[model samples]
Target: MKVRVLVSLKPGVLDPQGRAVHHALEGLGFAGVQDVRIGRTIELDLADDTNDEAIDRMCRQLLANLVIEDYSFERLGDGESA
Candidate 1:
């Protein structure tokens, strides 16, 4: 089985890296780019019988910083789908 985890900053968190990228895009002449926020995606290959509760625990314990970020996970088969 495959799992995908998305980690992102919570609302109201300031993202300086995202802001810098947005500015760089404007410098490169890309218009209509309103805002940008950076996040992370992690992919894991796991045993077939892994459960959602365990995945959630993994996210909370290691994948995401609960104080300032939020995360979610999706389980996939041999062919990935979310």
Candidate 2:
């Protein structure tokens, strides 16, 4: 099975890296951009039976920082939904 974990900073948290990218975009002549937030994506290959609960545990324990970040996951593969 294939699983994807997306980790992102929680609202109200300062995102310096995102800000830098936003500035760079403007410098490159991109306009009308309001704000940006940087995040990460993790892909995992697992057994077909791996459940959402287990993935959620992984996200809570390691993939996301509870204080300043939030995480979500999606299962992607043949005939899978979670």
Candidate 3:
């Protein structure tokens, strides 16, 4: 099974990298941009029998920093609807 985990900074957390990209966009004459934020993705290959509870545990324990970040995930299977 293919699992994709997305991790992102919670609202109100300052992101220097995101800010830099926003500034660069403005410098390039891309106007009307208000703000920007960035996040990360982690892909995992797991046994087909992996259950949702275990996957959720993995995300809480290791995939994301719960104190400052939020995360979400999904399982992707070939020709299978999500």
Candidate 4:
């Protein structure tokens, strides 16, 4: 099974990297941009029998920082990879 975990900073959290990118875009004459936020994607190829509970534990325990981050996951088809 292939699982993709998306981790992002929660609302009201500061994202310096995102801000920098936004600034750079404006510098390059990209207008009409309002704001920016950054996030990460984690891909895991696990055993077909892996359960949701185990995957949730992995996110809560290690993949995400509960203090400032939020995460969601999707199960990918068997043929998917990147």
Candidate 5:
């Protein structure tokens, strides 16, 4: 089974890295760039028998910092759904 986890900061949080990237993009002549937010994606290839609960635990325990970010996951395979 393949899992893709998207981890992003909560809406009210400040993302300095994203801001820096946005500035750099403008400096490089990219036009009309309004804003940028940085986040992380984690791809995991797990056993076919892995369950949703375990995945959720992984996200809570290590994959995301619950205090500052929100995370979502998708199972990526023809026979799977999240």
Candidate 6:
């Protein structure tokens, strides 16, 4: 099975990389832009029988920082590419 994990900073947390990108956009004359937030995507191929509990543990223990980050996952069918 294929799984995609989306990890992002929790609300009220600072995101320096996102700020830098936003600044660069304005510098390049991209107007009307508002706030920016950055996140990451992790794609994994695991055994077909992998359980949700195991996947959740993977996120809580290693994939994400529970202190300031939030995560969600999507299971993809065999025919799905992403």
Per TM-score, the best of the predicted structures is 4
Name the lDDT value of residue 64 in candidate 6. Answer: 100
**Model 3: runs farther than 4 Å from truth?**
79-82
Where is model 5 more than 4 Å wrong at Cα?
A: 78-82
The parts of candidate 1 lying over 4 Å away from their true place are: none
Query: Distance (Å) between predicted and true CA of 79, model 3?
Result: 5.9
Every model: Cα RMSD to truth: 1.7, 2.8, 2.4, 1.0, 3.0, 1.1
TM-score of each: 0.92, 0.91, 0.88, 0.93, 0.88, 0.91
Which regions in candidate 6 have their CA more than 4 angstroms from the true location? none
Winner on lDDT (4 vs 5)? 4
Candidate 6 — worst ten consecutive residues by lDDT sum?
73-82
Question: Which candidate do you rate higher for lDDT, 5 or 6?
Answer: 6
Clashes of 2: 0
Q: Is candidate 3 or candidate 4 better by lDDT?
A: 4
- Give the deviation of candidate 2 from the true structure as CA RMSD: 2.8
Q: What lDDT would candidate 2 get against the real structure? A: 0.91
lDDT of each: 0.90, 0.91, 0.91, 0.95, 0.94, 0.96
lDDT of 4 at 62: 100
- True-vs-predicted CA distance for residue 78, candidate 1, Å: 2.0
In the range 1-82, model 5's lDDT, one tens digit per residue, is: 8899999999989999999999999999999999999999998988999999999999999999999999999899775653
